[model samples]
Target: MENKKRIPNWLKIIALLIFIIGGYFGWTAYTTFLASNVTDNQKYLYINTGDTYLQVLQKIKDQKIVEDPNSFDRAAKYQNYTESVKPGRYALTPGMNNRRFIGNLRGGYQDAVKFRFENIRLKENFAGKLAENFEADSITFLKLLNDENLAKSYGFTKDNFIAMFIPNTYELYWNTAPEKLFARFHDEWKKFWTKDRLAKAKAINLTPQEVSSLAAIVKGEALHKDEMPAIAGLYLNRLQKGMLLQADPTVIFATQDFTIRRVLNKHLRTDNPYNTYIYKGLPPGPIMMPSIVAIDAVLNYKHHDYIYMCAKEDFSGYHAFATNVAEHQINARKFQKALDERNIKK
Candidate 1:
């Protein structure tokens, strides 16, 4: 009389299966959106130019930054990131979820690279350094630097183009093209040559390029910043009196052999535009990438009547200045004797 209808066991089994499936889907959604899916290590991802979306995903997988690649792929797909790939250097921190990772790549937010160059002595070396930092190759950068037409478009000759790059720490993007890199350098040069700087250059009766040429010599001569102004002033004196610059640094550059520690008589006889000893004016280009300190020292050179300079006999990276040939000869003799004593015959 009280036989109640029992629920079917199959129905209960089916309901339990539905609950389990729903829980699994919910967990996947959470991991894809809100849960942390990356491993516990900070990493960096560089998406270079011409990299495809699949290649980028493969790179991420190779880095093992994400704990769940499936979720990340799904999230990236959902965000439509595959349609627009951006190239940049992205930093991947620990515990990053798929949403955060995909959002960063989609937004095209990248980090800046710190680039610095000093004592760069050749255009090839400069090109290689730039290639190491940017997306462009060394050959491409060198081509642009050596191209007469391209350099003229920027108000420079292939000879004096080195003056455009001021040696200082610059913040640049990793994927910057060769022309964009040149544009940035040109902009920096323009900013450096402010009205006040131009006035100072005018006061000295030297253009910016001429000042750079002299500054390069001063930089090559003096190792200490404290003596640059004095060296610059001495060279200015030489230029004012229409004397040969006779800068030993120019001889070393003209030889194209930086191994020459001492500029010998033969080195000075090199017949090149860069040989200030043979020529009567500044070299056609900078001997090295001059620093800002050297450039400014030239602009604010010490007012002295000394027209000749020889490195000190002590080898302490300082120099001796003389206003007359007799004093210069005496200083030169002392330095020569010191070199002889050290057996430094170039």
Candidate 2:
């Protein structure tokens, strides 16, 4: 009776084969196609705190960025990265696989771009150039340059104006808003001055802002980097003694033009507070972004009773300083002689 009821061994084998094949196909569909990094090309993934793996998966699917989340999950589980995702803004692209797309999102790669404001003086020049390059509407950039409201928002006093702006290289994304661009630079400036550097400035009775102003003066005085510290000392001595800084760079800042061959009498009387030749006490704010050399010079300036300085004839990146008017006159004459010999019209 048991032998008569026994099923054929071949039929059992065929049924088992069908079951194995079907299981294999179902597993592939669940892991490879249905579970994976599903990101919508058009949707933005905002990853802040408290986001879970399932929430992330749902977002990927809802945005239509991925055709299947099940495939992504299966792959992620296999790699043991199912719960190791990072939190930040993530950008997803089309046709991305589960592991590749999930990995980037978990890594938090933000979009960015490169830009520079180094050696730039005029506001409109920087604004127009950057705006045009970023397709941000040139007119809008120029308006920001001239915008008093924006100026005031960034700790600018009524008198500070554009002088508070620090010039340097920068990187930003194409979608970066105008306000963000301004704030980013400001933040960078704050971090640029280290704790030790800040202490050094404080020891010299100069705030970070004051140090920057002094650095700007050093920048205008020295044609060569080697001359910076010495020139910086001369100005510091003058400032300590209540003497006029009388820096030529101040005149350039006041005029908003750097082409002045000489510091004319009229330049001293300009309306801008940046004119150190006329106004006193650090010109109300920084005149320009100073290099590290300038800042160091101010912090470690050579102390001297001498209140006057002029360009040395040697142009060896050093200046010949003087203690009195007679000595100053001699030094000035020597510089003038060299200038004349070289046919420099100053």
Candidate 3:
């Protein structure tokens, strides 16, 4: 009987202590963490070139953006976001707890579709690749290029369509609209042909299309930036004298190879319009996606009266410009000697 009575008093004391402890914890939790309410306001967070987690936290706090970076980071750590932040723009929002925020930062978010072009060869190939990545009708894109009756929707010509695609990296939404994609390429092409570029082309009496063509030629010849102006000058001189450009890249574009053994009679027979060796002035359109540097080289080609040039044997990415056929022959012999020494099959 005495033991049972003693047990009740001790149980009462333990219950009272438990109630006091629970109250303390509840009060602190309410004051510290639960005081602020999470709203649905939009916010933005930036990750700079080289930033650490602590630095990012400080930035977040200093900007008065997120009130509790520790909790955010703690949740990030729980979700293993030690290095989840990517370098670019992101649209953020409030009411996103640390877990959801970190999850998104770690690429648990909507992915932006990607388009890339490095060294693609033809328009058909381009259409096919676009079809593969972007869910656009590849057959339709091909039909558009081929002038088939199935799809006559595209506004640009086959040649103009190829010219419009800027060869570079692009980020777009997943499953893009066809009209928007077409409009984007055309818009980008027009923007690239800015007012400054037009004025320069006007000075030379070259049309926008002609300048675009010249830019492509300049790109093909000068494999190195240092030789751009020199290569441009040689072609400009050829154009002025009404002489054939005789550029090997044009032939290579036709033959689709660097191997010709020589610029033989047969290689010239391949009838691709890019063959400047057989045909006149410039190719019908831009052969490759011209770089800004190549465009500038054509615009500001040296005023020198150089008429011929051959590759420098040193492969210093510079060429030996010649004023006449004799000097060009000498340089040409030197290049041939180097080729022979290396047993270059081309």
Candidate 4:
């Protein structure tokens, strides 16, 4: 009994206090780590290429996503996430804690960015759009695209490199390199030109690039999708006859004046290789980015004897086809008269 009394009340109180303090600290740490520490308003975090740990923490703080950045920092350090910074778009939701957030960064569970483009007209515009959507800048992308040797290695010229990109949506990492982007396009191009497509191209006696070029011309000449096949056929007829394409769209391209409502005799004499009237063949490159519909239209061109076409006098976006020069001239005269009446002199 005396030995039992040797265990004093003050020592017992000290042991109880120690246990309570340890439990409180442990509960606080568990809440900070395992429990939700993210604000309800927080949704996502964007980690750019080559971001350091501090930058990531600052971005989290700036976005007001994390309630305790210090706790997150400690977790990240413990998980060795501070050294491995993954660059990408990350998905976050409300009520996420330091454990989950750090685990995502450490495991590199980033969201894939959706990439897409359409109706692009100019190379610069294409480059700018790509830059806006990707990590690469416009100048760097343009330079790589225009590298003649690099393009030749891919069996394309700088002029026809635009053909490699088929207009569609793609999923890729936000921090994809410029070279990787080019390779992805190349792969997509290969996938697009399947055996059946290759056979169709062979039957038409045109390379894929040539088909895309003609498709661009066809797309430029017609605003209505239904007219593409017939316009493609008309141009094919002219090509077969060894005659000038004489496509007004090519003249507009040569003049670089998209605002011209009418192609006059003066515009046709621009003397550029893109001027189909003077070149007597396909242009060296596409006049604009062609749609997949336009490309398929060229491949499945309607068999027709028509060699001429003119925009109809009606303001509706349609065209009139002619099998002979006389009919074509009449159609042209009618269109010119309509233009004159509308005071569209340019």
Candidate 5:
């Protein structure tokens, strides 16, 4: 038999060394790219608009979202996430590998925020809320809301623009731009005004905006949902007779002192156009964001001859309706006496 050339000891040692080194590097790569790197607890990562990759990394580090920062950095660089940062609100789940995390950041795989707003009293307040949830700042949202040309494009005046935002919960991406957000609201408003709703508006001789404004008044006055239709009807009667709405809520809004529990003569004397006691028609716009129930109440208001309303004396959040001054005065007196008893001076 031909003797096989014995492998050289030096060569065998070199080959073994190479195999060991390769295995070590392979294990390192596996840990860096495939092993769980995220913290055990779930967390949310908010990357604001115009954020650089370094800022995003710092946010991750500060939040302690990753179990091994070095591994995450290595995976991020390998996946080219450093150059492909996207603005968003992202969810970091437990047991997420660095590769998956970097991939989500690179691909803009973000979570939607459950955004909800109601009873917002001012555009600034709305803006602040938007800023609190979105990547855009409050000033950015305010600028969009105050842009006359932008409002006109959406068939809304700056004063009535808030009416477009129906009070409800929405699924919105946190990176939504101000213009896109306004467009989304306008889309929702259009969706709300179906053919049936449009016909109802026409029957009442009120535009959708007018309905929203009246609904806001109805919302402010009636705390009980069952009483909304009656209150809405009362206001409709006043509107038909060209009577001053004379709504105390309007005076409260005009005074901009939301703490006023009682609308005194001084409050009614506020000179702003929102003071329905001073202005003839529905104030320039809604005093507050109205609920869907309130808006529907205006659309389906009860037909009645009553032209006046007074909050009930028992503080039951119900109202007393009246057709004439004498009846209204009786109801008003009862309520005034209740207020005096409670020592509600404002």
Candidate 6:
């Protein structure tokens, strides 16, 4: 057999050097693009609207989501994520590599926030709450709510716009714009008013807005869910008889002093239109964002001749119903005596 030619020493050395250098680069690339770079902890990255890429990087650094900031920055730049930053709430999971993280940021792969609003007493409070979970500021949401033209477009007045927002949990992106959010609420409101519900409103000779307003009053008065229908019926009776609602909750809303445990004569005398004792019909809008339970109670109210309601003396959160002035006075006296015993003189 012919003898194999031995490779030159210098050429062997060069080949070995090339192999070592290539292996080192390949390992570095794997660490930067494929190896787990995110910390092994659950973390959320909130990128606000108009945020710069550098700001987003700073947020990541602040949250301590990534193991190496330089490697993440390198991956972001390589994937052109620095030029295509998207505003959103993103979830950073364990074992996430820089490549996948940068891809998510560039592709707008964001997580949805579980948004819930209920028992909100005022539009300002609602706006503030929205701002807490969203990229938009409170002022932005308030401006949209107060926009008369925008409200009119959705078939609602600025005062009654709160009625459109049904109290429930929703899945919404954190960066949803104010206009889109309002549209979503309007869509939900429409979904709530089915044909059967519309027919019920017509039977009661009330609009959906009116029902919502009454439901808010019912909610404020009745502490127990079982008593909501009776309270709603009482208010309906007062409405039909052209009697003042005289709802104490309305007076509380009018006074804007939520700490008042007792509705005194002074509270009743509040000059605001929301004071049902002063106004003849339901106030301009709902006093609060009524619950679905209260709204349904108004739609299916308990029919009765009783026109007056007084909280029971035992503070059991139940009410005593009466048909005549004498019985109502008796119930009122019992409640008043209880209040006096407790020294609740607000």
TM-score of each: 0.93, 0.61, 0.63, 0.91, 0.94, 0.95
Model 6: colliding residue pairs: none
Q: Which regions in candidate 4 have their CA more than 4 angstroms from the true location?
A: 1-16, 39-44
Candidate 2 error regions (>4 Å): 1-111, 145-153, 158-169, 264-272, 315-317
What does candidate 6 score on TM?
A: 0.95
RMSD of each: 2.3, 8.3, 11.1, 2.9, 2.4, 1.8
Q: What total of clashing residue pairs does each candidate reach?
A: 0, 16, 0, 0, 0, 0
Best by TM-score: 6
Model 3: CA > 4 A from native: 1-109, 114-116, 137-140, 145-156, 258-262
Query: Pairing residues by index, what is the TM-score of model 1?
Result: 0.93
Q: Which ranges of candidate 5 are over 4 A from the true structure?
A: 1-16, 40-42
lDDT over C-alpha atoms for residue 343 of model 3:
85
Worst 10 residues of 4 by lDDT: 1-10
| Model 3, TM vs. native | 0.63
lDDT of 3 by residue, 1-346 (tens): 4654355778999999999999998865543343442234435565554567667667666765556655555555666667665543345666655555555667735356567774445667777877776656688567655552322243344454465666767786435665577667667767877898889889877776676677777787787886787788788788878898888777887887755645656788888888988788888777766666777888888888888888888877578888988999999999888888988745
Estimate, for each residue in 198-314, the C-alpha lDDT of model 1 and write its tens digit: 999999999998889889999999999999999999999889899999999999898898899777888878999999888998888889888899999999999999998899999
Model 3 / residue 51 / CA error / Å:
40
Tell how far residue 318 is off in model 6, in angstroms.
0.7
Give Cα-based local distance difference scores for all models. 0.89, 0.70, 0.69, 0.87, 0.91, 0.92
How much lDDT does candidate 3 score? 0.69
lDDT accuracy of residue 272 in candidate 4? 97
Of models 1 and 2, which has the larger lDDT? 1
Instruction: Give candidate 3's error at residue 103 in angstroms.
Output: 13
Rank by lDDT (best first): 6, 5, 1, 4, 2, 3
Residue-wise C-alpha lDDT for candidate 6, range 182-287, written one tens digit per residue:
8998999999999999899889989999999999999999899999999999999999999999999999999999999989888888899999999999999999
